[model samples]
Every structure is written in structure tokens, then in C-alpha cells.
Target: MTLIPRGFTLIEMVIVLVIIGVLAVFAMPDLSVAAIRGQIKESGPLLDVAKQGVVQGYGALGKFPANNIEAGIPEPTKMVGKYVTRVDVKDGAVNITWGNSVNGSIKDKVLTLRPAYVDGQPAVPITWVCAAAPVPKGMVLTGVDATDMLAKYVPLECQARAATAP
Candidate 1:
């Protein structure tokens, strides 16, 4: 057999190490961010429940619900989920507070679900919007937006600007 080595060169080994380091650096933030987003998504079902309560109240009263009680939802402190500590319905908006086994970066952060509908048209179906998302043209948004979390930790659809069917 020939005396030539079959192993990688020193320079090639160094290059591979550098590439791995670079990839790890880039992947760290995304991994952490994805973990945070997953924790936040655990509250989605609770938010939907609150939204339903709000819509029921609106349909029955011809106006938005004033609070959890008016919306027929459980008390804010009583509506708890795996990663959410409370779900509050105020002025027909569902505000979710993340906590209770959530990541430190997102604990206590709030996300709001606001209701939107065509102005003066009760027949039109109600639509939901993320915190601070612009209401569609000719739509009215009811309730106060209480989203207090950073955009990076939210789902892609819930980032700074959320889109709704117009």
C-alpha cells in the first residue's frame, strides 16, 4: 500500500470547525426564539375561548362585552393554561398573560386579541386581529390593545403587523 495518508488535512479540519462554529452562532438565537414562541403558542386555545365569549356577548347585546363577566368568561385569574396565567376579556378584547411554567424571557408578557367588524353592519362576520394590527378598511376595532411582548417572541403571523382577511 502507498504511504499517503487518507485523513483530512489540518487546514480542511480547521475550515470545517470554523463552519460549524459559524452555523452554531447563527442557530443559537433562532433556537431560543423558537422555544419562546412555542411557549407563547400554548396560550392560543385560551385566547380563542375568550374570543368566543366576547362574540357571544356582542351578538346578544348588540355591543362589545365590558369585561370577563359580561363576556360570560371565567374570571381573569381563573382562566389559566399551561403557559398562560390568565385570560382577560376587556371591552371585547382577549388579553392573554403568559406565565406559570413559561420561559423567563416571555413570562408575564401579554398578547391581545382584538375583534374587528364592518362598521354599522352586524350581519358581517366578526374577525380577529393580533395586538396592534391595523383594522381592515371599513372595519371597526373595539377594546384596548394590551399586547406588551416583543415581536421576536411571537408567531410569524403575530409579528408587529398581523394580516387579516379583507
Candidate 2:
């Protein structure tokens, strides 16, 4: 009795691999963009919370906390972990910077907020910075214009910086 081989042929395997490679090539860019967007989204609420804490601290102590580690800044004590590495009010604006300690690869993100002239008005436009890392591919970084991806999410305080020009 002759037994026939039951595995995929070499050509079939190569074709499958090529198909997968094509799919990955097509999907990688979108996946990376989505991941960046997701990271930004996840960071938003954390920033909001940190801003609220800063406002509260300002209200109580008559000033924003000296830094993230100072009392009253709400140092990510609960489920948020210690992602909030720094928080400080500088040059009439609050700056909140945070990052993951695990991988240490992603750039530390900064969110600057400036108090609006109108009470309860949204803090000026947000801005982002790559903090010791290169800007991700397909992502543009602008140190001035708010439309730039990195600059869009910067807090108002940082926006004020953009408003001023030498």
C-alpha cells in the first residue's frame, strides 16, 4: 500500500506566506495610526483628571502643586498607577506630563492648559511633544500651529507659548 503525503506543498506554503505578507503590509500603517490614536484617547481622561486636580490644588493651596509628586496633585494613587510623572504650573499655565515606565520607549507626553478668559471655557488647544523620542512615522510635529497632530492636544498653557512669538 502506498501512502500519499498529506502536507501543504512548498508552492502552497510560499503563496500563503506571500498573502500574509501583503496583508501585513497593507494593515500595518492603519494599525499603527489606530494605536497612536488609541494612546491619545486613553491619555485624554487621565489628563482631564490631572487638570482637575491641579485646579483643585490651586484653589486650596492658592497655587498649583510644585510638581506631580507634591501633595494635592493626585499622584495617580489609585487604579491609574504612576503614569503621571510630572505636573507643574509654569508661566501661567499647567503642564501635565506622563508616560509608561514599563517599555520606556514611547515618548513622554505633555499636556499644557491655560486658564481661559471666559470662566469654565475649555483650556486653549492641546499640544503634544515627542519627549526624547522621534516623532512616529506618518505623524507630523509642529512646534507652532495647533493643527499639527502633536500640537493639537497640548494644553492651553502650552498654547499660550504658541501665541507668543519672538
Candidate 3:
């Protein structure tokens, strides 16, 4: 009787490993961008806080706040989180600057969240437009856009919004 091998040959195993290595090389950049994207999200709570201040200011003053003090939030430079170095309220927009132990790829990048509301309607709810995201029809976009991060590093929703713009 003849005996046959029951397992993969050493040459075949090496070839499989080489294929895996090549695939990983292509995936590394996307995976790194995903990690940096997560780091950007770590500042969401901070952004939300700033948003509240802007909305409240609009509610009480019948208009959006022009700066942090008017919005009742801390100064931009004074605000700090694990990965966020600053959060600025600019003309009713929240501008978050990433840094302070964050990944080097995202350091010093700014992400803007501008409030959108129906023109001439103070009671209408405010919708936030991220980065350079498109605003809903009939809604007015407030504040200057300050987003400077790479598109791949922004949130998926932010990208989706931009993609749907006219």
C-alpha cells in the first residue's frame, strides 16, 4: 500500500502566509484611518456640550451666539478632553480641534458643526451640518465652516452628507 500526505506541504503553507502578508499590506492604511476616525469620535461628547450652549443661547436670545461667552461655554483653549485640545463656539458653530495625545495624523485638525434652522422661524428645531455637509432645503446654515481634516478621517455620517449634496 502507498502512503499519501495528510497535511499541506511546507511550500504550500509558505505561499498561504505570503498571500496573507500581501493582503495585510493593502489593508493597513484603511485600518489606520479607521483608528483615527475613532479617535475623532472621542470628542463627540465635548462637541455636544458646546452645541447645547449654542442652542440655549439661540432660545434665550432669539439668535445664535457669536462666541463662547455668549454661548455660556468655556473658552476654546480651556476646553480639553482625552484627545481634543480645544472646542470653540464660533458664530453658532462648534469647531473642535484634535490634539493633546491624539494620533499624529489627526493632530491640529479642525472639525466644524454648524447649526441649521428654518429661515425666519425661531421655534423650529435646529439641525447640525457637519464639516462642509449640505444643508436641508429651506434651512439656513449658520457660522463659517472650519473643517480641515481629511475626508476619510471624518465620521461616516459626515461623509454621507457631503456625498448627497447637489
lDDT of each: 0.83, 0.45, 0.86
lDDT of 1 by residue, 17-97 (tens): 999999999999999999888877766677777888988899998899999998998999999988989988888888888
lDDT of 2 by residue, 1-166 (tens): 9999999999999999999999999997666555554554455566555555545544565543555544244443341434445545442244545565412323465544443222232242222332222333333332221122354343333334322111
Q: Which candidate, 1 or 2, has the higher lDDT?
A: 1
* C-alpha TM-score for every candidate: 0.88, 0.43, 0.92
lDDT winner: 3
Clashing pairs in 3: none
Candidate 3 per-residue lDDT over residues 78-149, each given as its tens digit: 888999999999889889999998889889999888898888887678888889778888988989999998
Of candidate 1, the 10-residue stretch with the lowest lDDT total is 157-166
Clash count for each candidate, listed in order shown = 0, 12, 0
Q: How many backbone clashes does candidate 2 have?
A: 12
